[model samples]
Target: MVATRAQLIWIPSSGVGHLVSAVEIAKLLVERDDRLSITLLVLNPPRASKSNPFAELLASVSSSTASAAKSQIRFQELPYEDDPSGLGAKSNMSLAERHKPQVRAAVAELTRALDSPPLAGFIIDMFCTPMIDVANEFGVPSYMFFTCSAAFLGFMFHVLALQDDEGKDLSEFKDSDAKLDIPTLVNPLPAKVFPTVVLDEEHRVWFLGAARRFRETKGIVINSFEKLEPNALKSLLGDDKIPPVYPVGPILNLEVTGRSDKSSEILSWLDAQPSSSVVFLCFGSVGSFHDDQVNQIAHGLEKSGHRFLLSLRRPPPTGMLRAYPEEYENLAKVLPEGFLERTSERGKVIGWAPQVEVLAHPSVGGFVTHCGWNSTLESLWFGVPIAAWPLYAEQQFNAFMMVVEHGMAVEVKMDYRNDLGMETKEIVDSEVIEKAVQKLMKADGHDEKKEKVRQMSERSREALAEGDSSHLAIGRFIGDVFKNIP
Candidate 1:
């Protein structure tokens, strides 16, 4: 058992992707050193729905008594009342900004309830940087944890610096077709694929405020590794650009539970398939498509004649299209007419899949993904290449980085947007879907792609091992926090 203890409290932003990253990194830190303990303060609103990931994460941790005890980590809910100051649905910046005051108050209340010696430090997610003030109030050091790739951070920093040096943002390039001049980028970002933050003026202001706040923190901990983003990491660390940078990453989907059971329908079907034969298409949990888009996907899969599994969610009530939940209750109803019947032999559709487990399976060959960092890292961890389809946020940039910059993915559409904001204005036709899937799973010269990804998978595993780069970064992070702890 660990003799001396140092507990650090981590507050993650309110979303599945952000919450999962914090939990994964928290587990990695504890595993790397038993003497370290973590208290995860999940921010759940009083009127939150069951769909919230915080409850699910806490349940998973509570179910694992042995692991929880061994790691000496605790979970707490930092419940708050909602404020209606920000706009709805699309922008994360609004939500993050609205939660600032409430989070500060909740954390102050929580500080009084703690019985142990004062916390070693605060590890706050980027979305919750307002909590850094609480750490300062108690004379404790605080660090920022970025949930996305280091490359995205590098680009955002460059953009922010540009705005200060010159009053122009990326929006100026929308008409001129200019490329951003960042140090680490070999090729410049096109005007259309610019991060949504710069496209919306309010978002740009929120992002600039967030970036300014990040500079105030003691240091930053990015969920990336040296090998994954060498130049981006180098540029960020050089010039003392954005506080002290610690690259501790390749933090994967370390679910407290094992893979889904063999008896589950999808897993059972996958077990019978030959090795590396099926393509798995899963977007993020909140991701789904329009009915027109869904139909096109079905047509494409049938044309390709490849075995596939696709995860789709029914559209929301107020969106552009109508959802047929009452009459045609099944997913087939949402697809193109007669499409499912035709592809029944080769395709399986589910509302949700055990994504991490499914990716780890031997029979899985490729992924049609939204290019979220979690999904990208998980795909690389399992040696599965991607058919990159980025819908929103920093995903377009991620697609660019993976397919163009890194050469690990085939492009479905990096700039695929149907509507300007949240809705799709046009459908990805059957021809585009068919071509992308074929290239990912069945193209002739695909062995090199497979071999490249498989090697990346091995490197990811090695990066987190005892003596690798990520492992050493974690060691340094721990030492920096507690080496002078009184």
Candidate 2:
């Protein structure tokens, strides 16, 4: 008599960042436990096309994973139809809501298939909480794969409490001086740095609803390690109402593939520079700047007098909801005149960056980032200090945690928000950028901070080692799935 393997279905958000993290965890689960087989139900963007990068990414992942043993990890593209009423373009949540029927059908077919593995559970992205209903219909447990910091998770719970438990209106805090005493952080959270979702009425309602649904899941699997976020993880674990929390990460996909030509150029340039001398600036996939802001940054790099590698992307056209950053055809139009020539000795500017490889380079000492959670973990994993420049979503909160709560980063502009129109409420001037870069790259000014990050990097690795915090947490999660198997 052979034992049956437990089957899990993963529904990740359409964004590359979220999908990549989900895929990494799915791979981790299958590799750690042979009794588990996972299927990722890939979601296509509303207006997906042949040239769509999301489709290409899914193809690349599927192709790469085709060689895995026994095909334990699989990718299934969920059928998507454009919303005729144009509601899908409104927000990611709305688009996910429209996919519930497809999800239900997919889950039902998987469960009913002959010789199918026993259904263990459904693992969903944070935005796909509506699919919890589909899980409930099948009488199987569901879990959320939170792609952000544990601190951000705690913050969302706090936001929900303020709205429901205390009947407090969250709108009043926008741009105000009010401070929130969230249990996740050591310091009080200033209202100004709140994630844009909490401030916007529609997004706030959607997020609060998601937070409420989070309690219905069996547990949450966060992509952050224990030592780096002890306070938040402890706070979450101690809470009785929230689902059981598992901190099994710093789960980064460190493999750098694709873009060989551009990556080779970037690496060759870094090879010639002095060790610990370059400041690498890269915002996340959708992060781009206005022409004026790009000019300021170029000037800033020139004045900072440090070697640099800048990944500059063109902003999406206005009113395009699902647009991505495009590489500039000619850099001279956006950058200052003679700027590239003047700094040619010490700087190299490119479009798309191989971020993980760049950070792993010895010549890279500091990072100027958009402070996305994935980027944050990557920087810490490589022991690179950060200059936080948050653009949108929950990034502002992430930046605050790095610079204010943890002392791992210097502030470039914590409150910067670039929305659909590529319009910014505030522009970080060249002087501010110069000073932040200087502070981040100075030899003696932040030795303590630098050492702290280096030590944290070691702890991050240790947490994932056998018998350590993250490893044990993954074991616990797998055990729970087995226990729940009927």
Candidate 3:
């Protein structure tokens, strides 16, 4: 008798960040269990072009997997169809909901194929929860792959319970001085740090609906290690109504591939800097600033008198939605006049940084980040303390957690939201930026936040080792998957 291979279907949201995380988790799953295989149902949103980062990354992964002699991982591109509902292209939630029919068709075909292995379960992205109905049709269990922090997950559940069970209107809390008593955070969560979507009526409804659907899943696989978020994970596991929680992560794809000459140049520049002297300022792919804000940052860096590398980007053209920042044609146009000349010996401004490479460098002492969970984890992994400057999404919450809950970061501005079309009234002036950067890059090398980050860095690696927290969580998750397979 031969061992039966179980197949799992992964449906990640259409964003490049989400896809990268899902791919990393899928790779981890297959490498751990030879009897398991994964097929990713790739989604392409409207107006996605070859230049899109998601497409480029998918092509790269496919090419690498194709070269392997016996690869268990495969990619299945879903047929593209414009969302009949005009709202689908507006947000990730609407876009995922529009793919329900396509997902159903793909699962039906996969189940019908004679050569396909036994279907195990559906692992859907946090935004793609609408596909849970299709999993039910096939009599398979569905699990959610949350790409954010465990504390944020707890916040979502709390929001759902507050709205449904307690009939509390969350919008009233906006702009108020009230502090929320969420179980995940040791301190009360301030109203200002609430995600912007929660305040908007339309987006809030959609987000809460997704949170409600999360309860239908068998479990949630969070991309965070246990030691990094013990209090939040403990609160989640203690809740009986919530499904089983899996904390198996720091699932980073550290391989440096398809490096451009610009990346090499950036690395070489870091090599010449003094040890623990450079402060790196690189936001996420979509993070950018207006000319005025850029000027403020420039003055701040100049006044700090610190060695710096700034990854500045131009915002997308007018009327373009869901677009990444573009490279500026000339740095002189947006930068402060003669600013580059003044800081010539101490600073370098560039676009499209190789973030992991820069963080891994020995000379980088601190990070001024957008507080995206992936960037936060990378900073922790490299033992570099962060100046938390959140831009959008759940980043504000992540910043709050790091600065207030974990005491591992210096707060630049936790509640900043760069919403498109809105005036950025709360500009972080040069003075605040200068003070934050100085505090973050203090030369004492004995800052408590830095020490805490260094300690978490070691524990993050330990969690993934044999018999540790993350490793055991992975084992338990795989065991549960096998148990559910008929």
Q: TM-scores for all candidates?
A: 0.89, 0.96, 0.96
Local error of candidate 3 at residue 304 (angstroms):
0.6
TM-score, cand. 2 vs. native = 0.96
**RMSD in angstroms between candidate 2 and the native structure over all alpha carbons:** 2.1
> Where does the lowest 10-residue lDDT sum fall in candidate 2?
83-92
Give the lowest summed-lDDT range of ten residues in model 1. Answer: 319-328
lDDT, candidate 1, equals 0.73
> 1-486 in candidate 3: lDDT tens per residue?
333688999999887678887888887788888888888898776553223566677897777665541468888988766754332223666666677788888878887999888899999998888789889988999999999999999999998899999999998877788899998888999988888777666668887988899999999999999889999999999999899999998888677767789999998888999998999999887788888899999999999999999999887655454467778889999999999899989899998888999999999999999999999998998899999999878888999999999999998998888753322477799988999999999988678999999999999899889999999999999989988875
Off by more than 4 A, model 1: 1-5, 45-54, 69-71, 83-115, 256-263, 319-328, 418-424, 443-446, 484-486
* Residue range 1-486, candidate 2, lDDT tens digits: 334688999999888888888888888899999889998887677653222357777887777666653589888898876755332123676667788889889888888989789888899999888888888888899999998999999999998998899999999987689999999999999987898778877667788988999999999999998899999999999999999998999888887556588899999999999999999999987778888899899999999999999999887666554467788899988999999899999999999899999999999999999999999999999999999999887889999999999998999988887652323567789999999999999888448789889999999999999999999999999988888765
Would you give me the overall lDDT of model 3? Answer: 0.85
Candidate 2 lDDT: 0.86
Residue pairs with colliding backbones in model 2 are none
The weakest ten consecutive residues by lDDT in model 3 span: 83-92
Ranked by TM-score from best down, the candidates are: 2, 3, 1
